[model samples]
Target chain A: MTQDSRTNSIVINGLNDSAFKVRLNRNLEIIQSVLANPTTVIGLVIVILMLMMALLAPVITEPNMPDPYQMPRDWQAARSAPLTPGHVLGTTNRGGDVYYGVVWGARTSLKLSLIVVCLTVVLGVTIGSIAGIVGGKVDEVLMRIVDVFLSIPELIFALAIAAILGPSFTNIILALVVVFWVKYARIMRAQVIRIKQRDYVDAARIMGDSKIQIYLKDILPNSFSPVMVQATLDMGNIVLVGATLSFIGLSEAGIAEWGVLVSEGQAGISAGRWWASTFPGLMVFLWALAFNLVGDGLRDVLDPRTETKR
Target chain B: MSSADKTILSVKNVKKHFPIKEGVFQKVVGQVHAVDGVNFDIKEGETVGLVGESGCGKTTIGRCVAGLEALTEGNIYFDLPSDKIALLEDSEKQDDKKVSAEQIEEIGNSYDIGKIEGDLFNHYRRNCQMVFQDSFASLSPRQLVSDIVSRPLRVHNVCPENEVIPRTINLLEQVGLGAQHLYRFPHQFSGGQRQRISIARALALDPKLIVLDEPTSALDVSVQAQILNLLHDLQKKRGLAYLFITHNLSVIRHMADKIVVMYLGKVVEAGNTEDIFANPQHPYTKALLAASPDLQSEVTSGMAALDGAIPDPARPPQGCSFRTRCPVAQPECGWEVDDVVRRLEHKDSIFNFLKEVDQSDAFNAKFTFETEAAANQLMAAMKSDDIPDAMKKMVSKLNCDAEHVTVSFKPAKTVPLIACGNGSSARCVLVNK
Candidate 1:
């Protein structure tokens, strides 16, 4: 369909018995387009599978009754190859079931990444909007603080913060949030500065809307699309970074995090038991790839500049 | 025009001056006198047209009345009952200066919108709304038509939550849109449609007064007429008072009951629309009428184009602001050294020969030219017929020597608006004297 007709249909179908239904239809359309792209579909399948594993972690590991967080000591089954009936994807040198580790690893990876991304976005958007909208001296002070944080490289800053706080689940999440929030703050602040000057904002003021009401209802919603796309893409990177910290032992030693699994399996790789490390490593690659593809698909659908091309 | 007519809005000497900031510390350097001592009244069901060239502060005055801009000085009293208005007028008659802010505030039925606070401010906000010029930019792109039109109702709590949508639909229908347009964003519509949507949004609150700021400037001529007619019908139906701000004389001539002609932030002429159009008292008003194509007849030979641009607001010339460009400018039209310099600045050859200027004030200046001939030429130009006869008559002193000329003019006071017969007033020195 031509762009004009699509716009017309959007208008015609926009308001009805419920606004919720209109939003749902828009989301469905975006999903349909994402599915139409073959590469994105592959990514979607991987993402869905990962989500299922994360959600059904206990069920996946319950049949064998292996504790995902414990090291296996059954020497007989320790180095068993892939396709073992009791232990699929083989076993580690310490006899931990790789299948169990991978299944429960999805939960740790997804949870930490989600928590970090959500925290960063919330912190960044609030601070950024306040800074841009308030302007003057307050803006100058906040932006200088942002500059101070931004001047340090992300991995280095996160590492320094993590090292200072000591290895723990919450500390790692904190470090990631501190390092990632600056990116969102910069982008959201720029968007706020541009959007606030638009005449609609003035019109909203004339409509007797308070500043907070205008920000939440008129300004922020319009400025959030790019931030959302950025957040989606950042999710993949956040997981990777979390895993890197875990591999370096910033997290608990025997946790079922994918990076810890990779670190533990590195010892047996030269002994020709590559399946132990390779499977978990493949899972990490697939997780990041899924998020990246989804982010790309979202950009295509949400960004008006690219909508014309589609 | 009658004493029985009710006044919905009375703007008394409204002034809005915006400061110009310079350097990093944002030190105030000067102020732009956007609306300088403007006064007008809109009856409960009357349309008042504010006409001027761009930057004459017509929009600024509208914004002031709509409570969008805080006044620098002056008060906009809203919804004054006739008895209280008479009381206010009696206070004015006693001694306008002694009419205290408390006295002004004590008027039971009137609310001074510019100074009102809290609940009263919100009350005035709900009662007076504005329709902006740029419809596309004025409507939030992310919002649906239903939300945009219903926003005022929602903001003021004008309707129950469930009734908001239906009320919005009714407003859209009034503006010529239908249920099909409710869910659409502003980008989905053309310019004309977008303006209609804006109008619907403004009309949502059932305001007693609506300030329309160049509502039809961005639309096509045909579309302009349609919007004007819609406004006329809506006004008649609702008994709405409109502060219509526009530079388009023909549009105002058709819609306005009272026409106010502003020049450089001051109202130069104001009267009934037909009387002002038929017998314009102010030179600026006459120039504006001549420039309007629809008001001109083929038998009139040629349209009189307004010469020169609007004076800089920060440094507006000392007298009748219109006098600098008024064809009928007189000796008493506040001619100063600034006028001499203004004329010289535009004449390149004479200006290039100028060397130094020593001034005591706006009325006196001594010029040293490049050579004696330049000084002689300057003296001659002051007496030439090209100079307005009024200006020549006011030249109190003109002395020329080898390379210098000193010219002084009789100091003239700025002209104040004076009442002519037939409910018209003009700020012209000729008419005032």
Candidate 2:
């Protein structure tokens, strides 16, 4: 880099440092609160390990793909059972390694959740903020529209959308995003509506702020708390929705998704071949459970009401 | 442009009435007369204090002037100059008087506040800022003091973005907040400090007319004194005008050069603060001084208070609004049949039983009674001296035909605030009597 470029970077760094220190301090305060609770720490560790497992999927597993219809040629090699070297948790009817499937399933689940969450939070907050700030007949109409979506069962809506969109992991995420955004929009809209009436908004108005300026500067930033808490909690629900869609056969056409593995295990179970479904089912349960625990623990920490409670 | 000669803002007979919505369909029932015909002029480089009880619409008047609320009637004349003030005064002649939007922008750049456009509104906004009552809720907690104070400067392009923090720190210092406080959030500061930051933000625009709307009503007395003194010093240095609104008599006495005492929604008494304080002419003004706990007489005598509660603003008492609560209510104080019933109804069951009252402007009522004895009792009460004598005397006829007592009160015109005893305005019949 040029010397001038380095100087410009330094100037920008100083600006960022000064601008966001308070936000950083508040984030650190949340991190410290999580550290204060041991169960929360354990949940955090589980999440960290899950993240690692998802990231290291290719490195740990065989590069080759498993043949879904391949027979277990060597019975003992297939029935080597859990705790045996290389054959941990035994093998499926297709002779696929259970450990490899677990690693790969973790990757698919995490990636799917991250995509759904990004879509839900971004689209949801924007829609909610507009509905909230432009309050009047528009607010009433938008809220009723949100109310209709929120009233529908999450499972039914996901299923109906997935059915129409056809079975694929991408389609499942799209369906879940559609179903999940309503909650963020509702929480955020309510929060914005409440905060927009506060005296700060009035002060902003008296300061000659236009409606757009008030919405961006006064309403949205102050209304961030409820949306933040909802977002954290909504992660668990989003993951669950993804897994449920996969279980109902809306996963990538033939790839081994956790839910599809569970379905495949159920098909293999009567014949006493339970490894395929059981391992993937445990991965899905553990991921969802970890997210929920972390979300609940973060909620107890990030929530302003809880601070007041203490 | 001369300091001592300019009339900064002229408020004409301003009236603001809020509509009352009632019933299943939510029909526009009637207007709640929040502010009815108020007029006051705020001079350049002077503090004009607006004092009244909580519901007297002092804040409403401030809001109307500040353009927070729309005026239901009347005009607000801003002395923003022909450049700023001249164009807004044009309610007609748009095309002929038309300057291009760009030329209007140039006008904004060249003229005083009353003469400008977009930039002038920005200038007017910066010049005529307001400080709110509740310091606790006024500042946004999530924001840093630097950001909050620098917000106005940024919005109006008062300074370059890089110069913002330095300017903000300077403003913070000006308002008693310092360098150590700039990076802190609103919750990190105490109430007084937060209010100082709010003042700093208001001052960031370098406004000439700061509307301190009960700025000290929500602070500790000592803190209030500090803010008051800061405001005093700032005004002295900047030569600013302030429209100080408060219910606190003592604070208004110390701060205002001219005081406007409001009752119901009208200015009942207005003059130099010394004149109003030394010899409060209006009976309502006397009652306010009597009621102010801080200014109790040293005689240890029971301070004379108005007898009843404030008359309902929805249907404010006719003739004189203060008559219902006046220590000296006269008979011709527009003592209507309703007032006679209101006065007697509370004392006995004679009023408690009557289902409905059908009143007419003809000073008569159709007889509708649950029982005849109740009607007779009402007629008897109207004749008694326990009620106003003028009510008993001016009441031309009382004919109790049956269960309905058709009584007629002498029709009296609504008394205007007329010049009365020793340079005072009295809105009562007896003042002329």
Candidate 3:
């Protein structure tokens, strides 16, 4: 009886720890696994640096005034080479400051990718989850729509939508959102379908848990990892695609965007004024490559097949 | 430890058919009769073992009981009063019973698992819980042990928020776990430990009945015994009724008070555990018993191993579903045209030459072959030793004219389960005698 009482006290002490600690521990474990790989760490570093650059663009470079996103003109340093005093990283033939453009380009790309990713993820996950959970005729109709979206090549499809909507950064974002959400919808739908069949979901249902509760607790958490992996991969791909759209003159001229800077710099390339285009072009490549690396690492860590080992 | 009078659950002629869809439109072409017309009862504190091979619909029956799958037909009355259960049983036994149809309907509407809604359904859910076969699949990987075990308590508001933790701890302790295991995920535990966690979760709501769907099948032999013993002790302490479903006869023999032996989608034999073991009336039950290894029996003759594969559930045989595989199959055990086709379809020499089959019904068919010789060969094959004597004996007509060979079997009725004394029943023609 005394032994039982002693154990009971221990139980009480253990139970005092909040559920938050459990969640924290689980999340910490996943983070640890994701950070274990060297390439992921490198990608993470590049992503962090890029994010910092974007966040601190105003502090690093003086705002262009009226509209900070529009590149500041420097007529005196037009076509100037890199490292020239007051004209660092040179200037475009049209007098756009390349330094200001590179720094602010990060901010533009970040804003564009973040908005598109959030919108597409929300839209895709919602539609996919509804299709998966409801199933039958509703599933059929929704999936057919997803199929139509998925049938065309993503770039070509986005190009068509952007072209139709008229050339602008916002239109490009809208086009990216349309082209991107379908893959996520397909992924999330498949994941939900698979995870819903799991015994835990059925167990939850058997416990008289409402359909919404079952979806939230059993189905959603288990199925969200793959969506996350896809989201991370798309984070980089979106920027690359956005830049490509802007490169072809889809975006507003003289804006502080990497693709537009590259487009402006391309005119002076044969005259050896490559700094203007090369720097912004390099930023795009690094941004895409970094996310791709991180996404692959996340896949390796979060893939359900490998999850059992942990 | 079972109190013989009060019934906890009454499964009455339950059937569950899953549609097999085809084409892009998903048109329903056929149905897989997973559980067809199963009947049984679990009294308070009793353990009724549902034993069958895989695909015999034992799991489907368990799912039906757990309210996982909506029933295609019939009602599973939960926690009906003893008198009502007796009245229902009486009505089943005798068509001209005194109990009115409206009274049965009232009882079903209130107590049926499928039909009840609102507070009544919640009450049933609280009373009934299930421990799945795969512990890994049953417990949420993302949920902590405390959360997994305490979820039911919290959902039902069985206790205050603060009290949930202590109650969950108590439950864990009951299942042989400790407070240290509270914050750990499911993957942190061994197979046996995970199963213990599952049991703790099942016991959280103090359920009156727990459906054990092959709970120990995924564990090691030693672990299986430990889990079974824990379950037994828990049942004895809580007076919980259990519907233990498994294919392992040894496990069932050790745990079950009453045994229901199923073949295909129907129960072939059901009785008190000892009675079914000592005197298995159905050939399927006898074959099952002989197949299962027994320590007490020194000699392993292995004579009763059944031959032939289970027939397709979509097109289940006309009469006895097990007659196709039963060693002691009789002439009266339904023989149909499908059986002949099934037997000869693999024989390339005869089946490859067959052009078309004009099946008028299950028992009668005309085979139009590519050549007259093939038709004559089929006729010869029917009379040959390759066909079972019972099936050959049941054939009433066999004629070959040119490329057309007509074969007909004696029409047979669907076999019904007959009472074979001592609170037991068997679904075989021999049982009627």
Across all candidates, the chain A TM-score values are 0.87, 0.83, 0.94
Q: A1-310 in candidate 1: lDDT tens per residue? A: 4776566455444556446665576568678987888877887788899999999887867633355454444567888888997788888887777887788888888899899999999999989988888887788789889999999988888888988999987899999999999888888888899888776787777778898899999889878987898898888888888888887888877777788788878899998889888988888888999989988887877784553233
Which pairs in model 1 have colliding backbones?
A: none
Worst 10 residues of 1 chain A by lDDT: A63-72
Better of 2 and 3 by TM-score: 3
User: Between candidates 2 and 3, which one is better according to lDDT?
Assistant: 3
Off by over 4 Å in 2: A1-23, A63-87, A91-98, A164-166, A250-254, A267-278, A304-310, B1-5, B20-30, B80-117, B298-303, B306-319, B335-433
The interface root-mean-square deviation of each model, in the order shown, is 5.8, 3.6, 2.5
DockQ, all models: 0.29, 0.39, 0.61
Off by over 4 Å in 1: A1-23, A26-46, A61-103, A190-213, A247-249, A261-286, A304-310, B1-4, B86-101, B108-110, B157-169, B179-190, B298-304, B323-413
TM-score of each: 0.81, 0.83, 0.97
How do these models rank on DockQ, best leading? Answer: 3, 2, 1
For each candidate in the order shown, give its overall lDDT on alpha carbons. 0.83, 0.74, 0.90
Candidate 1 per-residue C-alpha lDDT over B1-433 given as tens digits, one digit per residue, 9 for 90 to 100: 3233888898888899999988766689999999999989898888999999999999889878877778899778998777767767777676556566576667633478866777887888778888889887788877878889999999989977756776788899999998878776677788889999999988988888899999999999999999999999898888888899999888998999999999889999999998888888787877887888777762133437888888889988777888778887877777787777677666647767888999988788899988898888777777776577877788888898789888888887777889988898988866744
